[model samples]
Target: MASAPGNNLPVFYNDLIPLSSVDHAGYRSRTLDSAPFLATHHAVPLTVDEFVSAQRFLPIIFSAGDEPVPLALMGLNEGVNTFVDDQGKLRGPSYVPAYVRRYPWMLAKLRPDSDELSLCFDPTSEALGAFEDGQALFEDGKPSDLIQGVLKFCEDFEQAAGRTGQFMKDLKDLDLLMDGEVAIQVPGNEQPFVYRGFRMVNEEKLRDMRGDQLRKISQNGMLPLIYAHLFSLQLMRELFEAQVTQGKGPVSVTPAPEPAQA
Candidate 1:
């Protein structure tokens, strides 16, 4: 259901095809030196499992929609990824979200009615296909060790995604999510660049939560994740600076949102 028609696959995926030994006996999985798909993409989905590591570098925000998914902002503005160059090469040491690392490969359900997910990959990826010199996907018409490892990784990612869904549900059930906004003032300008179009854990709600509610979430390890997200917002300014440094600032300045009343 996630994938739409006519090559409308997930982010970084141009086209997806189920992996099978019968059809891909000669296929090989190659090491990608660069990721062109990520060059222009600014936001990447993140799992709760990656909250701690991802918060150190990227601002984790929830997507603005009915099904809110956590996203690590590679850049504050759209199509302005400051971490990677135009060729999709990393410019500095940073934490790469597993969603990006698992790109070109994912476990997706092939049919709407079935719950069984199959190992699928983007056929357009330069790192995968019938390559002459790369890790073989199959050996003697059977899944090779390389395929086994890839399948395991995809499975783990799926599990993490499930946990992330539950995390979002918990936040919603507690009424802790609120529209997110960040205003960063430029040195020479009176008006700050205000960014919105995302959601964040409402710190006020969290603080005002009852004792038993707090204890329950804290014991379940949700407290730390919420704190990680709240703390990650501080990096938005850093991300904006990176965009300016990379000469990829937003095309137009947006008016700052009204400040909240104390």
Candidate 2:
């Protein structure tokens, strides 16, 4: 299950194995006891479908890259997740990203040239194996109900991804995204700590949009998503306070570097 450095695998997924009746006939999937694996990630990928619920807890932002993805920030600092304790236990009630809930199993293209995707699971995950206490992956050499459900979930996620991609493209085409930064002043600190490394919708630009364009965005159901993101920004201070409470606060007061432009 070891992965080489520079592998683009998502967090906690060391290796992906395409599920096959012949190769994984005896495999079984079990319920996970905890999500300590998510402790190392400060942000998790999100779909636009999650904006409403997710906005209530975590601050949502877009990562800066060629293929920017929406993300839910669990913490302000790199590799520091205030929501998860050192023991990997979640601290309080919060919205869990679908990306995290779908972990240990994902849809992947098995070949570079193939457009079709296959259901794959992490070979290193302890929640899967030929165990007595879980659901079987196959029955009579065919996929079991459990596998079918997983496949359905993956399919739905892919569809959501397509929608999210189009949404991002629309934002880009409208030139709504701008470099974003936030500052937090901790107790006993004269200087405020600044965090960056992300992009956000420019509210001023959004407001300046023509009435017809606004109507178009509203009709597409994107107006609420934009508002949700803007509302979530208020949580950045709360997240920073959580980090301070957890003793994982940033040590330096320097402003974060500008994120690489896509």
Candidate 3:
């Protein structure tokens, strides 16, 4: 929740819950009251919506090796109900800077084909809507309060999602970072192997290289496609958690895995 000296901002999750209908439906029979719905379920400490909204953005920090250490966090009360304690109603601009408002675009650029991106930006869904709501919620509270609200949300998130699989993965990666690890993938050469490391010098040098050099380093596809899926799931979940802790609602829930079409 604390800011750095250079005004660099951290990532925060949005306040949108996943719909249950997205993940749960029996092909067999089952009577329905309406088109199946997405359930707003949380582990009690923090709802799924709260958890996901809180972890949308992945901060690009410099590792000891000068490599970009992608850090993600959640909790931004853009439209919070707000608690006023006198001082004549605290309010003003959002903690989210105007330039960073383009975060979604940046993330999109990282992986345009990402389903995670689609789900987060689903217009019909409540992701952006709830974010705006949190912004308005603390329209009259201290900026510090907004940050505090987010912090509380994340703390609760640690209790909830941190215990679940998807969330636990994110927490593990986050912990790695806290311990000075840079989560990165190394393309293998002469063999198909992916190496994810939390610590390594010259990491940035490896990341920044010409195609031939990069290809030579990754002839074996060091970074597997599965890494993308894992990153996406964890990253997406983190973004959503940011918003939820701020009192946002709505989160997506994956329908039960469908049986193979034999």
Q: Candidate 2, residue 209: CA error in Å?
A: 0.9
TM-score of 3: 0.18
Error of 2 at 197 (Å): 1.6
Q: 28-57, model 2: which lDDT tens digit per residue?
A: 988875787888778787899999999999
What are the clashing pairs of model 1?
A: none
Alpha-carbon runs more than 4 Å astray in model 1: 1-8, 251-262
lDDT, candidate 1, 1-262, per-residue tens: 2342234467677777888878888998878777888888788888899999999999988887666778888886667788998899899899999888887787777886777778888887889888899999988888999888888988888788779889989988998998888889989988888888888899989999999999999999999999999999999899888888778876553222121110
The C-alpha TM-scores of every prediction are 0.92, 0.91, 0.18
* Superposition TM-score, candidate 2 onto the true structure: 0.91
lDDT (0 to 1) per candidate: 0.81, 0.81, 0.27
Ranking by TM-score: 1, 2, 3
